[model samples]
Target: MASRAAAVALCCLLVLAGCADSPVPTDGADSPSATATPGSSTAIDAPPAATPKPDAVEVEVIDIVDGDTIDVRFPNGSKDTVRLLGVDTPEVHAENDPTEFPGVPDTDAGRNCLREWGERASQYAEDELAGETVTLSFDENEPRRGYYGRLLAYVHVDGDSFNYGLITKGLARRYDSSNFQYRERYGTAEGIARGTGTGLWGACATESPRTATETPIPAADGGPPLWVSEIHADAAGDDRENLNGEYVTFANAGEETLDLSGWTVSDEADHTYTFPEGTEIPPNGTLTLHTGSGEDGDGHLYWGEGSPVWNNGGDTVIVRNGSGETVIEREYGG
Candidate 1:
């Protein structure tokens, strides 16, 4: 009877041990059967990591407020209004603010002219900015962030620059006190436009007006024929030896064909070369002159001499007509 009781007790103990070893489902969602194996353990499954996103390029057009101020669009899809630096167009506001002598044409004609200038300037801006990626940098002195919390950046477009173009065309005047990056270049272009009276200056008649005078050249349906715009010294090596060669290039800015026969290129030293009889420069084409040349080097004029006559460091080159009148005179600074 005692032996029988011992066997029964041992069986009960084994059953209790098996129940303790079995895994219990922690939550109804997970299966109790799914568990780590003994000896060699299994790893818990985890989610994949996420990839980071790239930075955005900032750009804005704000609005074509007048000819200078524009609405800038921020990277966060926010809009901020900005005034352009280094240029001031004629005010279109209706303050009736009158100047001392040659005030802005308050008359209908003057007002109309101002409006036209504004339209042209806007068109130029669109031509420059549309479909381009840009970065906005603001002037330190000017409000870096406008009242609306928009970043005011000085626009640098495609590396060529547009501020200078506006000033050169007399569309905008220079703001001297402003720390404009292209101030000098813009100032120079403004001076040239004012001197030439290309745009608004041509309409104004006042002497010593608010703006400078522009000298008007008669409108030419076609511009000048083939004309040389640049010259460079074609010397090779450190010896600085005069390669006995110089080149004169001609550019035809007009639409008509320019015959090159009688045209001559001469230096102040009187070394002259007449164009070959049949040479012709098509509309908007370039013609080069060279000597002992195997085909013109890159189509630029090449004059290969046993010794070069034109000074390598610098010298004056003149293009002339058959009549000996000067067409263009360039001093080669190279």
Candidate 2:
């Protein structure tokens, strides 16, 4: 009886020892603090990690420099000039390179047609990209740099090719280099625009060039001979610093080239400035008169001093031709 009792006591002690040796079941929350193992961590309930963004850089359009070129600001706060791949538009501004396309003839009539079409192309690009964010993609197989060190890229606006869109609209032609990857696609788009006679292809096809002797110039087709098209009296940034801000745009609505050498633009107080000698306003062309001073160039002239000639409150602008005849008068602000 004593041995049997001893054996039972030993069995009970062994069972209790085994229970203590085994790990205590824990819900982690109810357990005492413990050091985490090297390869393991506590399960965490958290939102899934965010997917990484693509490598393509995003930029804001500073300006639609033309149909093919754009000025952009990058994420790193750097500025660059980007030339679109596979497309070219008519030159709106003069080019430094003598080999550039759609060369305008020296004749006034030929220049007038070029100016009109160039303006349309510029306007079309501005309407689509001005102040918008776009993505710039480069060909991995081709040289990234283009003529003049401008970055050659495919500009995408909301995943649609901006270059391709322009070609389809007939505002641009397929101007592809051997390095261009989208040459075939762009060529096809140009064909569609040409076949349908879209935009410039159809609109300007039958238009005739005008000479200085041409009567009833483009703007006078049914409208006034000349008119004030745009006025920025308040300026875009600061009129105090950027005198060009307070300016007025005059468009020639007539078909004849007007020699504006002695023409005058005046304020209500006779603050008059005369167009310099050799100033010529072409048919359907525009001239901008800046209230601030700078060297004059094509399409723009300076008043040669600063201190706000145009009043933001109310102002009247009178434009007189060389003969002292008031051709256009405009009022604003009041």
The best candidate in terms of TM-score: 2
Off by over 4 Å in 2: 1-53, 95-111, 206-334
Model 1 — TM-score against the truth?
0.40
For residues 249-301, write the lDDT of model 2, one tens digit per residue. Answer: 76654446766778789999889999999987665466889988878997899
lDDT of each: 0.49, 0.61
Model 1: lDDT of residue 14: 46
Mark the regions of model 1 whose C-alpha exceeds 4 Å error after superposition: 1-57, 92-108, 130-132, 145-152, 176-182, 205-334
Clashes (backbone N, CA, C under 3 Å), per candidate, total 18, 5
lDDT of 1 by residue, 1-334 (tens): 9999888866654443232233432211112222222221111111011111111123556456656666655544555555555566665553322231133455666666666666777767777664455444433234333323333334555443355456656676665545434444455445445545656655542332212212322113233444443344564552135342445545554446766566677777788877666667664356656533445534455554555656767667666666666666666544
